[model samples]
Target: MCRLMVYLGDPIVVADLVTRPSHSVMKQSFAARERLTGGPGYIPLSINADGCGIGWYAREVERKDGDVTPGIYTSISPAWNDVNLERITPKIVSPLIFAHVRAAMVGTPVVQMKCHPFSIGRYMWMHNGEIGGFSALRLPLLNALRPEVAQKCPCFESDTAVAFAVFLNQLDDPMVQLAPTALAPLMAATIATIRHVAVQNGRGDETSMLNFVVSDGRTVVAARYTNATDEPASLHYATGSAFRRKKEASADFRLEYHDKRSRLGLVASEPLTDEVADWAQVPPNHMVVLMHSEGSFVDTLVLPIDCESPEVQDHVTRCFRALDQSIADNAPQALQQAPGGIPRALKRPSFATGEDVPVATAPETIFEETGQSVLSVAADGTRVFSGSPAGTIHVFDLQTGKLLHTLDDHSHAVFSLAVADGRLFSSSMRVVNEWDLTSPDGAARARPRLLSTRHHSDGDVLALAAAKGVVIGGPRDVSIHVEKACADGVTQNSEATVGEQKGELVRARALLTDALTGGHVSTVYAVVVRGRWLFSAAGDAAVKIWDLDAGKHKASLYGHAGAVMALADVQKQPSSGPDADAQKERSNGSDAATSPSDGQEERSDAPDGGFWLLSGGRDNSVRVWDTDTRECVRVLKGHADDVLALCGGFGGRFYSASADGTIRAWSTATWSCTQIFHHEDTVPLAIWPTERGVGSGAADGKVRSWLVDRK
Candidate 1:
């Protein structure tokens, strides 16, 4: 018996979904709630008695500042006992995740590499059930793998893992790669290859549990089928928005089927969750596929035959002809559909050259220049939140550059700043302090209250902000810590506090601890909080999405030219059409499509309500990407120096701060520069929107308040 979980949605932390969930994969190894083989009598369950394994892949993120190769992790130990699980779960995030737990059906090997979810280069394959004639047909199947693939087979004797290698090898064959007009045909060839050797080796009419899964680190394909009469195993698939929603309303979240945004199609022998509506049974002898397109399901028939029978020769020949026909019939349709299974092509962005406009206008005069170096700026419309490298926090008038009040509350450089709930939170080199910054003069000589203290271990604190919660990102500790407003108000000294509540706060406390620390090789650069998720960019050249409530990673977004320095969520249009039928056919997770077994009405894809994410990098350009579609909507390039910070306004206005000592504004639609405000002595480090308007903080210890026409 084997258990598997496939998650497609926002990148989530492996621990929150795979390890810590009520019915987590970790628990499934010993105490699986639902068994595919009827009841749990067939296989004994116990965390200590049963062996477990997990396999996962991370996405390759491209940033303007850097790029990262995708990462994969596999384990053989019981997930709960493995210290590494706790170590790496929060640190790594991916949008598309696959996890599996094993309860060996037949061939139980002591070695770890023999586990399912096998990998060949970027491709990973796993099988839930076993082939009925594996023992008798092993030799024939092993021989079917090309010599190259056979060579990669396990030294240890596990049938499932070995079978996976064979499948991967066959997939790499030139024939399958070049001629896959339809995946069904290629899959048919694989099945034929397996049957050929089984009979030649004198195998029997074995009933095989062929619930198969494979992914090339991008597209994932899973199938459930058996040669038995009744049904292979209990397999289920669920799709819709509710399956992907968070488990909690707070930032601390869990996986719950709330909305239908999450379209999950699971092909398990038995349903993982008890929600009957959340699971659907995969019909006998049929294959379900999850690709970019929603309608990727296809049914194929493979008649079972006895090995060593006179019909063997006929079976082989028939198999070849059937495979050829299936492949030919499926090729044209698959090719016509573009990447991500969407039939329609994405629109190319329009760009303009400076030569087209000989005389570009300068920024309109708004706020009188404040002669202070701004380290970070966030404004609404009536009030401004500004911080300086000199450790000064200020609140000023957006309409006029009148200095509200200067407070010397911090002791180190304020590299980043954010304002929310009428309070201003600023992060220095080693500490996080909050100012009762509702009014302009709130910072005047007023000592800021300390909410939390984090020891600096990496290097420096680069970014910080406060919203529904407090978020801090920097080079050394690159972790996010949230202190609810109720957690405020402790004036006790550090020694007394640590001794008193260390035991209670140690458990179930969502605060950032030593475990959230970054790996020595990587640095966290910036973090942006939106609803229940936290998006972080790192020195590793990746942008990771974390689910705050669950305190785990959701997904990792890649596709940038450099290390992501800034992340901002803006608005955008729907890339697909309005017809309900057409939209349902399109794929959502990564670039794979899913087709339903029962022919049903199609869904439409029109512009729905969603925001676009803008990330700036050392690559010296800004990319606007649709969060829902995960497609790059636009790319704007004009910065002279590295773009260090970015902020988008509520009125379609966007602003960026750079090493070139200037804050530039852009029209989100045309992506054209609207204004360029040059700083003489101050170098803009970070920028954000405040209650009053847009504000820019600089390296020269000055915070500038800017007023823009919102029309």
Candidate 2:
């Protein structure tokens, strides 16, 4: 069996677990002390020397923009012989780590992809044991996976890769955060599914050794299991305040315990230190869970894996039957698609339609301000709010096009504006101010009253989004500041400003409570909140999804070749007529693409009303992503320059404004550009869609509203 080790606790250099320990993973590659001998059709060897891999989450200081995904390094060379590992491990540090040294099974080729610690999206997995008769059960296991999961599966000829696929299939949404308690059961179920598949295929009697460890950066779940009566491959875990060598030159490394709370937790296929008391053996058929909790503590749990239970067996059988049925129905169509095998709905369709693209009629209303470039715009049914470099927020009546108010609370240019919860939020420099839309003095005043202000320490807040009592601001420093309202639905600030009649100034309250880093690798350009999920786009050309409740990164979407500048959430409207029905029929090849999987039922805060995310990037394209599948469903390419702003969910069309000095409106149904509005001599910096048409904020200090003919 291969050797595996995982760390989930305080930040530690990769060398601490991979090479520095007396009985480290690197040392075990040549001298494994507790490795079991003999397996079907395999030569017994105490040494694991085929290859090695390590995956770890980068600390904030390690990368420019905080990245949530782990950085992985793998080598086909033996762990003990890999010179690069020695030099690299000492420089990388992480709070969660997974390292593996593989001893390839007899007849299996040694390749880089075959190395342990296989990863897909945010999750990383490594296996120390083999699935007996894996060759016989491989086909059935592959066929059991959902189409999307099957597509994500690496094309590797190893049981570990297929097992990882099976595990991912057990998750409804692998792109979201999952608790260790919830994850452990899924691991057990994955093992159950594998056993059921093997038994159904006449490999039930084969002794299967399945030692698996999986982690999502924050939580780790490891299992040591075997159907045979012989003791499973050695697995042990040690918890302490820290894990380090007693002396720099000494080989005596142990877990240092200072208090009851564990600040360091390490799991390994074999002990990594000579101190026997520092490690505890994981019982056979049991899984160990290590979850990072508050107060810098790692909570550990050891639970039995009950795969043979009648209830679990029934569930697996039903799931397998359903998957079989699905494959039988869609396999033919899937084979007929492009070599990429991506569903037709998720592919970019031909854009050769010769039909004339419509041009928007002349401006219905134009609001001009001398010497002030409009940088951001937002609308709330009756009124429009536009932010300018002149440090003023201009409010106007949407229907009447009347200049209603100019709020001048900011001393710097306001780069972002968002309307949420009957309030307006504007960000300038490092401060975000919340304004009550209904005047605090009286409605006759027609001016918003300042309610609260949040100060960010990172840098100037360039992007802002607010929803569900949570405000998210992306600063120029490449981090996201998250502020949540208290239980009373309001954040109380000690400083209060009296109305204009009182002539008293109120300093905005500081609401920068938690900041999420390691999600982006460059300057965060845009941020949007959909339900409880936060979508942040950055100059790194990636859009990252985060769980707002836990303040954890869920998944990253990569496709843009340049900085992603804007983001919008569009709720899918129910279609009508025969053509709409036919469209739905065509998309049935992947039903999971349209909605959350059954496993996401526990996420009560999941966005409602089926929404798709639209992201615009400096690559001059807009991407439509299915929130459920976390896959880019479509790429709308027509922008001639960098797409700087996006606004949608009005009149079945979404608007995109670009540096090319034009605003293009795309039909949500056809994913085609239907109308384009040009601004002469200036670029459109921001856009806000209304019931009749769209409004644009241009660099030329003008705000123009264009109306499109419904027909």
Candidate 3:
């Protein structure tokens, strides 16, 4: 029950799609001719007489010069009896390539690191189904990775190559430590951490088959899951086109389209040729992206799962009572004339009255695991620090979601999670530890100390923040250091050589010479620092405004069309006595970093501290923004797909996730969308909140725990 393929646009040759495709994947390993069986159809079968494994990669050039990177190769022989894969499949070439091909199924074994493009540096991975209960969740999911991803996972065993080393130890930036536009949250948290360890061993009703293919040789995410929502399997997708082969002798390749470089893309679980309109189909269980040069699509069922459908739970209880009456009818008539506040409109003007208070009932499902996802959620609101996708980090309690400590110390997935003071930070790619969790009991032999490690010679820690100390971010390392507070071990930090600060690096060479004199697109991704000001979000859709005590370059802002992911601030909580020293004597009587002229309107009786961001895109809508008026005020819409990940939290509240299996929350003073949640057959590649109220991580490898009660 497996077959996969993913080949990015242009630059070909990994044997032009695995040993000259005419049905290649090395001729479907001795004749697979595209398998997909299901009774009355799908007959062309062949597991290549039971032995065949291949995993190519190309894009070299490093014999010294500079930029070129990618070069991997894995083989268990049988790519038609490799003669060095027929002398290196027409001599390597790549834009981004991943070639799978194997046919072993049932418990599978064949060795050579269990083949299939599974690499770790410059990240390359491949998979094609069969994870139904993996030996009943293989020892609590291999005791949840992170002993260097269970000793670099691949005991010559095979659960699709130990589920890509449990997705490189549940990734927090490990495509060999990143690049390729941060690889779609590590291929959506490695297919939700192997469907949450095959539904914790019970095999969650069998039928698993997740077809995957990832790449860091420059972005390429390919997935085709199936937990059944109307039976999914036999995948097929071809974008724009271009496969060719049959001019006469026919082994079967033929697709070709082009239409003047709309660019080509292809994903397959079946259909290597016979272009029925250049091969469509891909709908079962979703996910298919070919980003950058565009040309590829797939993701739509329009959200709603977790077993509902009573008319989608009465349209999500009327979209949560129209978002609590649109924030109590958009309050903000000067906060209902100050005083003791409480005009009772339900605190809405983008929300600020005891924020995100839902809990009328339902919620108690303690740590269920099953294709887990919950990427981040560090809490102080009573202790909650999640992080999953199988690199593991559990630690619950939020008034009893129970399970206090799990921590498998990341091998891959667990992307960023922070929690000040009593400690608890986490990360994945180029490491980042630091846990103490003031533990009242929660203990997995509680150890985690390593205060610093940074590294990122090319990129890894994709995003993390702890304010007043550790920052981390990604895409070839975006800076923001400080950490020294609680300290523990791994303290490396020192690599600016190449002529140390060639003149404070001339402002990154004047921002790459203003991106070639004005074609800018920023690319930072996301960074946040509060007190000394630092806010970012790039891909050039613009949003910077740094100052980090003048490391230079401030003011950038611009708007967003896509790219920028998440950031938050929204003020009003800094009171600790003297009626908070009487609001710091009314903000030292006003004016602090001014800037509100243009037809004026900047009132703050000392409290608007400001900050709202939300972002999320590829255009499936989340929007928000308002950092003191850089605009974009509201957009919300009901996620049917794209939005990919976001957090915001506590009281001006926000959550999002998308590619649409749903995770929602919203309420920035009522841009609406109150609950939603769902998650059913998975898609959400990350969602957070730990001191307990939310935690989601999907792609179907399950890691759910929601208790958020504010009533």
Candidate 4:
């Protein structure tokens, strides 16, 4: 009837997995290889294009202490043409992800809200089969629901929603406590209750098909069940270290064993690829328990849902005359093993007892540094660069934080430093300079050579982005400079574009202003380039995307409450410019050695190998936007002050620095903050992400470093 999948692993970028595969979810949307009904005369709709959705734990950074619910993005757009899906999916990295492509049931209207992965509180659910005689049993079930839940979902037409409502009612407590073995019997009771109503309406077991999955961040309980047919629904599972290209499966991937214990679990209505041996079919009328702490396995006890028969009814009552008792008997140890709904909120004060307020907790500080400018880690990650307002560029050993050199030349604040082509480049008010850097040879410290000084803009340089030998630096104005390639007579609002002028050092010209005019209303705070797409953020609280070749603004997204602080593009295989010894480092300065490729299962990489943009703002929030749809999909919040910088790698883990003097480490798993780096002066002017750690430049003019290890 529909295609539904649940992936529980380390944060994985899903675009490549869902869209890029040969027989990807996109192909399944139109040319499904598996279905319940489809032949010549009765050629039913095999394509599931009705609608689709994705729900994922936005990231582990934003969860300080509140709910563990994920952010949902649904659209009526078909998966093949969902531009947002293409742009945003690559950007999203999650440990727990729920995705579904829908094929509207007979008599049902296709609506976005009606899409699968329906959610409530911290739980998310999706169903693959239909409710037998749903219409006849709808009112009876709604009428039977608790006033609170029913009142909210009264007219929620969908049978799936109704079933969830029934499940909620079975919980009884506002703050519900649950265990792995507790869900099956409550489900049995709900089905029994439905069966009772069905019999009252003269309907029987032959009318139902129910395969459902429910996840609450911490755990997942999935069941393949039905009373109507011997074949409840096609459900299969695969477990692995991470979802990677199965060498045996047509380049598409499936769950793979990363290790004996650190297994990644996946469940789907149909196998996404051709690796038949890797997938295990779930037995009809049985359930599977997937625990975050205990890998994945099946739940044995089958339920007695066919209560319409006299023998079944007698058996149900003989065990426990009441339905609650029947539900209780399934998990006798639940009363003690189940968690108390939410800890007493605020533990009783040592003396009296006051409500507890959740506060952001910081992580261990393995290293700390204080400096004046933002921090830049070399593409190789062996060096950290800092530019100071005193017109000096400071280079330090990334691992040990040892100062390597201090080149004082610019009289203005060293706002940005870019490393490319074996050299370090410094950008400031109106000027860009390149330098060659190396550890002090023998005794004398390495002095950076002033390769070429080109005035690319009249305004200050607040940000820099370099790709394919092009470095874009600007504030009120942004111009494109080709590494050391020099240019002459570049101005604003000029339609006359000069060809690349040859320079002495690098290949092409010195600088070239992009052809288009009128980029941003206020100061352009940041800019990033990927392929032909150009993204920029400004003080106008607006983020705009443009086509470099077309020279036009494609879409403008407005969300930040204050000025945009920083912008970054996180890609699977980060591309670096010409290999530079010192002065010519790629402006972005991503590390050379990638760690996700290592045996770290949680740092799994995406297959399609795409990129995403991360923007931090003065509003103290960071928004991840899908370049294709140009919509802000997720917002991460936790910093006490304005967010100044954002950086991460293939590990799908990122770090943020704030004016509150704290540097926080975040993982994509649950979008929760994993660690906090703190120090005396605290104001981290800039942050550089390392494969294994983070380097920071602070207000106190000292560089700090810290080692990060995620569990």
Please name the candidate that would achieve the greatest TM-score relative to the true structure.
2
CA shift of 665, model 4, Å? 42
How many clashing pairs in candidate 4?
A: 54
Better of 3 and 4 by lDDT: 4
Query: Which residue pairs of candidate 2 clash?
Result: 66-518, 66-519, 67-518
**C-alpha lDDT (0 to 100) for residue 156 of candidate 2:** 40
**Tens-digit lDDT track for model 1 on 1-711?**
677766543344556556665556666667765555623434553332234544555433322232222244556776667678668775655544667766654335544675555665555566777766677667667766678788867542666766676666656542223321134344545555565666566553665676676654334455666655756655555443223213453222222321111223334444444444334454455444443222121111122222233322232233223223323233223323322231111111122234332221232223334555555666644555666545666766665656666667666445566667755666665455555543346544343344434443322455564565444454333345554431343332222223226332211225342211211112356777777656676433345555565555443444443346688877653432223333322112322221111121222221123666677765566766554554454557777655778887755668877655566777765566766666554456666664434566554444555556544
lDDT of 4 by residue, 202-259 (tens): 7765457677787766455667777754577787765534456645445566443211
Cα lDDT of model 2 by residue, 1-711, tens digit = 788999876667788788988889999999888887746544446689889999987654554454556788999999999999999998876778999998876787889988978888778999988898988888999999999998888754789999999999988877675644467778998999999999999999998899999987667899999999999999987665567677877877865433223566788988888765456677688787776433344555555577444423332233222222222222122212222122121122222224478765368888745457678889888888888765789988787766788899987668899988777889876678887776545564478877677666544577899886667898654568776532223444433432221332333222222112224534477998876788887654567777776665655565664557799988785651114223321122432132222234454434443888889875578888767656666778887666888988477888898766678888887777888787766777888888788898876777889987676
User: Model-by-model lDDT, in order?
Assistant: 0.50, 0.71, 0.49, 0.57
Q: Which segments of model 1 are wrong by more than 4 Å? A: 1-372, 380-382, 438-459, 470-472, 486-521, 573-609, 678-682, 690-693, 699-702, 705-711
Q: How many backbone clashes does candidate 2 have?
A: 3
Give one digit per residue, the lDDT tens place, for model 3 in 483-505: 33333322333332322142321
The better-scoring model by lDDT among 1 and 2 is 2
How many pairs in model 1 have backbone atoms within 3 A of each other, for residues 3 or more apart or on separate chains, i.e. clashes? 91
Model 4 stretches astray by more than 4 angstroms: 38-45, 173-177, 246-251, 294-711
Local error of candidate 3 at 476, Å?
Answer: 11
